[model samples]
Target: MLYRPKFDDLYRTYTRAFHLEVQDSYGVASENEQLQRFLGGEPTTYPEDWQQWDAFVKEVTDAGASIQRLRVVTEPHSDYTRFLLHHTDRNVAAGEYVRYLPRQNVSSDAYTVDDWWLFDDAVLAFSIFTPDGEWAGGAITEDPVLVGRCVEVRDQLWPLGIEFETYLRGQG
Candidate 1:
């Protein structure tokens, strides 16, 4: 069986990590409550898990490494996507570079790729989601061809993504 390292392990080991998120809504159990709160017009406080992730990002970036994420979202964002947009400033404050691109802007071929995280431009970790958008698990590979393609996609999309604040302002 191929070994799948935990996300924390991958983040700690790689100096440069880039994430591409394509889902409009994710069914992460941990975030369901918060999403509901947002949808109901209640204030959604940052949960402990989010705080922990922010701290981790701060630590990694402080050590001279980098963590960047590009979210490809549909226009007229889904409820979950709006929830994410509302909270992304916390991620930015903690040293993660977050950007967004409208789904229409992506090429057909690029849009077919699943969400993934590339580490040090060497390893590729695919985020596997069920048809309903629930987190299933992930697969990690070091195959050069796969990694190269992910790298290429990252390079292609990164330039097109608008910075988080800019994108958020346009939404308002």
Candidate 2:
């Protein structure tokens, strides 16, 4: 089945959700206002639903499930990446473990190349996106080998990712 990112059903169905984000920019509608603010040198603001989302994350983590993300970023980061970096603290505070891995630091032979989520280490949700960075849709599969590859990629890269706080401080 296909599931949109941030679908409520995801939290209810999976014990853990881990994401790998490889893009430098995402042109999602939700980021429009914030992106403009960021480019205009205004102070960063949390998304409108941030509080509700934070509460949801807290509920999930408090229940012993987890939400972790590893982003592969380019050095001399893109504006969008800087925006994301500035706001990562909010995500961390909300109970998601966020990490950053420099693109140059990742081995080219990595098993999982595209953006995806490994839900409970069982479902591999491959994100399909347009060239302009807009979300097209996503595909989810439970094939054991495919799932195992994603699990392996997570295992290999997650440890190499820098903690959000550390990455933020070093951005200076």
Candidate 3:
């Protein structure tokens, strides 16, 4: 999932948490334990080279490249759908690096990480899977048009800077 060309610029590289490149640890992720579930066996499988995918994410974190995160798109009434925005927002606040994408034109499809199509258009899709086949997902988009819009949103959030806490307070 991570090896796709769409993810090239997003992830840096790696050699002991820095971009050095190696044989075994090519596509490993450095974010945290959550990424482990994404790499687990079946029910959730991907067409791309998982090794390359790991390398890509590891590189990105090592290089300090910005990551754009989107909450899972879902039906407005669905419980998962309702949790999407808040989940994405909370993850970002933790500095794990994420962005809540704009709503999609399509309706929710109930696709899980096991569904390859979910990560099909993804620039970089790295995640963890639970035994029940649920995925702790983090998808990155490299679509030029979408990237531009995401940057705009990030810019709006950037002004809050060290004072984002106060800004969030006001919004509350």
For this target, which candidate reaches the highest lDDT against the unseen true structure? 1
Of 2 and 3, the candidate ranking higher by lDDT: 2
Least lDDT summed over 10 consecutive residues: which range in candidate 2?
1-10
Model 1 Cα lDDT, one tens digit per residue, 1-172: 1233366678878899999998887777788899899999999998677898899889889988899999999988899899999999999999999999998987758744588889999988888776766656668899999999889889998999999999988987
1-172 in candidate 2: lDDT tens per residue? 4644455567668899999998888876777798899999987678766667788888888888889999999888998898889888888998999999998998867745689878898788888877767666667788999899889889999999999999888887
Instruction: Give the clashing residue pairs of candidate 1, or none.
Output: none
TM-score of each: 0.90, 0.88, 0.30
Q: What is the lDDT of candidate 1?
A: 0.86
Give residue 64's error in model 2 in angstroms: 1.7
Show where candidate 3 strays beyond 4 Å.
1-63, 96-131, 136-172
Candidate 2: misplaced stretches above 4 Å?
Answer: 4-7, 49-52, 130-137
Residue 131 lDDT in candidate 3 = 53
